[model samples]
Target: MAILGTSYWNLIDVLKAGGDGIGDVVEALTQLTPFMKDANVITCNKGTKHVSSIRTGLPQVSWGALYQGIAQGKGDYTQVEDTTGFVEGLSAVDTRLLALKPAQAAKLRLMEGQGFLESMAQTMESAIWYSNVQLNGKQFHGLAPRYSALANGNVINGGGTGSDNASIWFVTHGDMQTSVITPENIAAGVQRDDKGEQRVMDGAGNPYYVKEELFTQHAGIAVKDWRYNARICNIDVSDVIAGTVNINALLRKAYYRLQGRRSYQMEKPGQVSPGRTVIYMNKTLAEALDAEGTNGRSGADNFIRLSPREIQGEEVQSWRGMPIRETDALLNTETRVS
Candidate 1:
């Protein structure tokens, strides 16, 4: 008789499960421009985050007769759902710079090790940012990709369908948050064996292994209410002030939409950051904002060019008192949509 064997989890599933946790973490080195640091960071401590939000489709009110019974409302009552979005799971950067050759540490005075650590940290941050907003071409359900501004269908065309000059993403600190399941803490000044396991040595060791604490980058955006954020797309900045394609006018229109929304309720008093709207765009779009109108004054004041200054330890630019954060993550040459 043949021996019976129970089939368990597949190897790929086992590897994925391991990657999702801290034990037996595998590190893969990837390179890209990091910009996730610019986003508002909200720390969380859960595998999946549950975001509760009220739907934008609220029921409409209707006029009723004085003596007769009231008529039924036209729209369905909006309900808040506990929508859950998964956290991004990417292995940490595991690398370091150290001279292991005998007497090499004496001659090698430059802080190459420190520089490598900084560069690695920055690269990890950028990768997280890219993943946060990037569209998943495959395995759509495996990774919880955040809402894409370009895919929102709300666009400002440049010349036509494929040419987009500028894009705008209005995001609030509450709209999303970056959570780190495992922090990128450095485990330096230690020696490791050839098998890449840490071990103590009485004296200096040759060809020492650079052992560092690598972590998994886990983050999720809780768009509890998407009304708090808006993406203005299809903006063709090169177009001359035509019948209805003025860039400056378009910007103002987008700004007011956020300002005028019932959820924003700008008229209400004692609102925090009422004018503290954050506008994120790339350098190309930033320049377009600078040249939106005939002159600086006529251009979108909220999109004007401003000098960078330290705001609460972070260097950020302010336009019309609102922060105009420049980020290359917001791609300028994006596939256009109607």
Candidate 2:
């Protein structure tokens, strides 16, 4: 949450490792969104998928006398495979148009590329939180689907019953907890390949020369340890806007739902050990939390305070020393999580 460094490489780190121009493209994408900037990204251990053995139950321990023998117990484990999804985009520019504006052609092509980059960023941001593999097998399952049921120990109900609802997520980014992943032997961020000018057919079946660019990103979400993440679902947006919902109270519950509290540690300067937690909500919910801090209402000082601080050059709001990031990916029209 505090931009700590871990053994795993983030999108920027992976792009920079190539020592080329791809870093510029990734930098632009991360700057445009909050999730991409803070997401912990790693390479998939298995070529196109990540296979992990999750511990579901602990072994039993018993005390015995010196002459007595005690039975050994083994911990329960479940294997989970997270498959990476390929998100690709293509951009085509008429070759004639480039020739018509020779001096401005490079700038024009760059502008087109930026548009595609932004679109891809938004797609990935939404998929990370809402994609359901059961509904569409081509996409990887996301956090919302995993915690869709109230029976899930980490999901907290916000008392909303209608469709005008949203969610607040407490995600711990770590190798053993959760992380964003890319396929093995592939770069992490969107890879851009320039396909030189070629004959492209128009909608009318006419053939013409056009320059093409392909953008491809192979990524997915991996929740290796489910206990490290929590979600507060069914928040009524109207109530929050009317200053009626006690968001700080729900935030407290979500915080406690996490199995581990001290999930992050500072090993050294510019180096972050695993286990960093961040709180995510939409803009409406974020404004509600800010209002609570300034309104001087009851219980506001206990767990909510808006002391804006700069982290990595961007102003960030914190609740109990954890960064609270706002994203558009969490919808306000979500159905209640029953």
Candidate 3:
């Protein structure tokens, strides 16, 4: 069950793009639904003027946050490992010391989206992988940071002395990457196939048969839903990339997101502009504008911030009693006047 959080401002633009933009993401999750409980988490940028609205009935996890992840190069799709293992050829003292300091040092890089996902996966599955203990039989459990976690590639780590109890596990997915190396090393044993064929492991001290899914670890879900391991699914990369995938289906899924978010009655939670109106200004707008202006004069600007102040009290207010009003100019009243 994965909750995907993203910027809500992009959500409005997604809403404007005819409700289909988000449907794309929904379909992506839905296709994997058999294997996951997925939902999108849209973090709204309050600073952005556009209001967000649920366009589908699927559940959504929305919140307010600073929009930093939207910056370029923020989305990560890389796989990594930590120091929770016996150094293959390094001595115990050296390995333990090395585990204390991998890469000979550390260059902290803040992660987001998939990057965060991988980090968490590495941590979660690190012990299992480092020990070469096969959970189920297919995937090598690992750990990562957060946000999103799938599988990751595999690696090998072994040595008799310093690396005693050495083993290997299979890891998959790029999002399950991290580097929080634990000092203890798990030595389940070397990985092997059912037929007892030799296999290789990754640096995470995990191994695999070259395919992503872990045939055994995830077998229960796979058997029930068909997300089985080693199953080569030919999903149209272009379609997922275009986010214009099977429109009819995706839209229906998007509808789920739209409808589910409506349960909350927060004032702004349900806000959305009238796409078009026979009376450009609907009652809501007219009422709002009237309340602002009704106090003293005409036009939206007169009433919003400071009242006309009898026409000349403030630097911003012109003699209000006059007919021609510069009030509308105050629509962008970013500052205060007398």
Best by TM-score: 2
**lDDT tens string, model 3, 1-338?**
21112311123433442353222222121111100111111211222111223222434344546863432222223222222222111001112222333442111111112233333333333332222224323333222111011231111111112211211111111111111222222212222122222344544766432211111111000001001011111223233333322322322232232211221112223434111000011122223323444443333354443233231232322111211112111111111110
lDDT of 2 by residue, 59-100 (tens): 999988899999899999999999889888877777776665
The sequence of per-residue lDDT tens digits that candidate 1 reaches over residues 1-338 is 21112112222433343432313323343232323434444433332433333445666666777887765654443442222222221111112222222233222212223334445454443343344332542111111134343344333334435564456666544332122222123221112212233432323443323333332233333344444455666655444323235444555555564532322112336654332246666676666555553255443455434555565577666544456677555554555544
Segments in model 2 whose C-alpha atoms lie over 4 Å from true places:
1-32, 263-274, 298-304
Task: Select the stronger candidate by lDDT from 2 and 3.
Answer: 2
Better of 1 and 2 by lDDT: 2
lDDT of 3 at 183: 22
lDDT for model 2, on a 0 to 1 scale? 0.80
lDDT sort, best first: 2, 1, 3
Error of 3 at 38 (Å): 11
Comparing 2 and 3 on TM-score, the stronger one: 2
Per-model TM values vs. the true structure: 0.51, 0.85, 0.16
For every candidate, C-alpha RMSD to the true structure in Å: 12.7, 9.9, 29.1
Model 2 lDDT at residue 66: 97
Supply the global lDDT for candidate 3. Answer: 0.21
